[model samples]
Target: MTDLARVRAAAERLQGHVRRTPLLSSPFLDEIAGRRVLVKAECLQHTGSFKFRGAWAALTALDQGIGSRGVLAYSSGNHAQGVALAARMLGLPAVVVMPADAPRLKIDNTRALGAEVVLYDRATEDRDAIGAALAEARGLTLVPPFDHPEVIAGQGSTGLEIAEQAAERGVTAADVIVCCGGGGFASGIALALEGSGLRVRTAEPAGFDDMARSLASGQVERNAALSGSICDAIVTPQPGKLTLPILQRLAGPGLVVTDDEALRAVALAFQRLKVVAEPGGAVALAAVLFRPAEIKGDTVICTLSGGNVDAEVFQRALQRQAVND
Candidate 1:
């Protein structure tokens, strides 16, 4: 299981490999939230997402002889790119099983990072089955997106950074909002921030708010749709078995934001913070900006989880924001 000690160890492993993403704030964002808002720009991390931290941590933790055989993963985009890039850097082969409808930019980028890409249908195909078969046949290690202990530990390193950074700013108590898909990222942070005066809250796209519903019911809930929202990066069937209990124990009530709100956040992030945040990445920021009544205290921290958006999608977000302005 992932804990504070495991997270600390992962941080030590990731010290030189991972970039310590910045905790950014904008006066404009604070004005919108009616509070002080800080954005953790994980979109600036390697592969333009926080997944790189977990990927590197998981790969490096493996026995050298086992790692030499290569790695395999299934993701809509961000995790695939993270694993692919990490594998390339480590001189190991990678194979990614992705949804056929995933952003083309992400698919191309995965291949460019030297991973063999396998596309599957999100509606009919079982990604796990495909990945398992490939891994078994090729003797490849599976790098789970959110369920594994080491992966969660690696992701928790972000929470460590948040804790340190918030203290540096003289902010002791605040909500640490995260764009939660399968709960790994949020759960990891929750573990890291335990008793640190910073609490974690999950954010999800409105139609796909399984985490929010799951938190409310104290049991796992599944999303009805497989694909529809623009926030693909943080979309998953349900919270992970390993990650849910941690979240249920440590996280605050979950928050849900509409796709439009996410797009607005993406645009606003680009305009104000001068950072690019894909829709899924911006969901936590969207919750902070548009769901103010749900959040407590005068200060808030949220993550911009990834920036692997397609150019057309990014342009659309910017155009909509322009029209609204």
Candidate 2:
């Protein structure tokens, strides 16, 4: 279970290995939203995403015998990089199966981190099947992007930090908006903040808002199509089995924002906050900025979970803001 104790232990395990990214606030955002806002900039994390925490925690917790054969993982982007980096830290090799159409930078980063990259056709092949086959054939341990206990506990460390930091800032209660893909990050944080007076909410791409639908219906829901959005890092089909229950119990009804809204939020992050946010990472900020009235609190915390966007994509998102100006 991903409780406070597990989260704290993970935090202890992560002290020197990972950076404690700062919680930042902006006068510009506060003025626009008419409320106080804090952003947990996980985009600045090692491997340019927050997935590193879970990857490191999970890998390190395993037996040395398992670590010797290396590890296998399936991810479109961030999680692949995370696992590759974690494996490197532990002197283990890694193999990552990624979609053929995943962002070029993410693929390149995974390779640069020393993992062997295997590409699959997302439109035609099953990533899980491919990963399983690779693991079986090579005798590698498989680490899923989400849906694991150790991974969830590692992710919950973000919430533990947020709670303590918020308390230090005199925030007794707040709404925390986090980007949701397979629900690992969202549910982990939710579980960690269980008694801290902070409520978790999710933000996802409009057509791919399965977590939102699942939360409302109390059942798992799959996205009709994973394609057609720039948010490649968060195109998961449904909430994870282990993560959904926690989200249902602690998170607010999820919010959906358009790709355009997400792009604009990315632009705003660069212009105002001076942070790099990929489309998936910007969804939480998009929901908060574009639909401020719908959010429930005077004080809010939004997690910018990743920044591994391709240069061309980042250029295009920034150019849109220039055009609008």
Off by over 4 Å in 1: 99-104, 119-126
Candidate 2's TM-score: 0.95
- lDDT of candidate 1 over 177-294, digit per residue (tens): 9999998889989999998899999999998999899999998899999779999888899999999999999999999999999999999999999999999999999999999999
* TM accuracy, model 1: 0.95
Q: Over the full model, what C-alpha lDDT does candidate 2 score relative to the true structure?
A: 0.89
Largest TM-score belongs to which candidate?
A: 1
Q: Which window of ten consecutive residues has the lowest lDDT sum in model 2?
A: 1-10
Give Cα distance to truth, residue 80, candidate 2, Å: 0.2
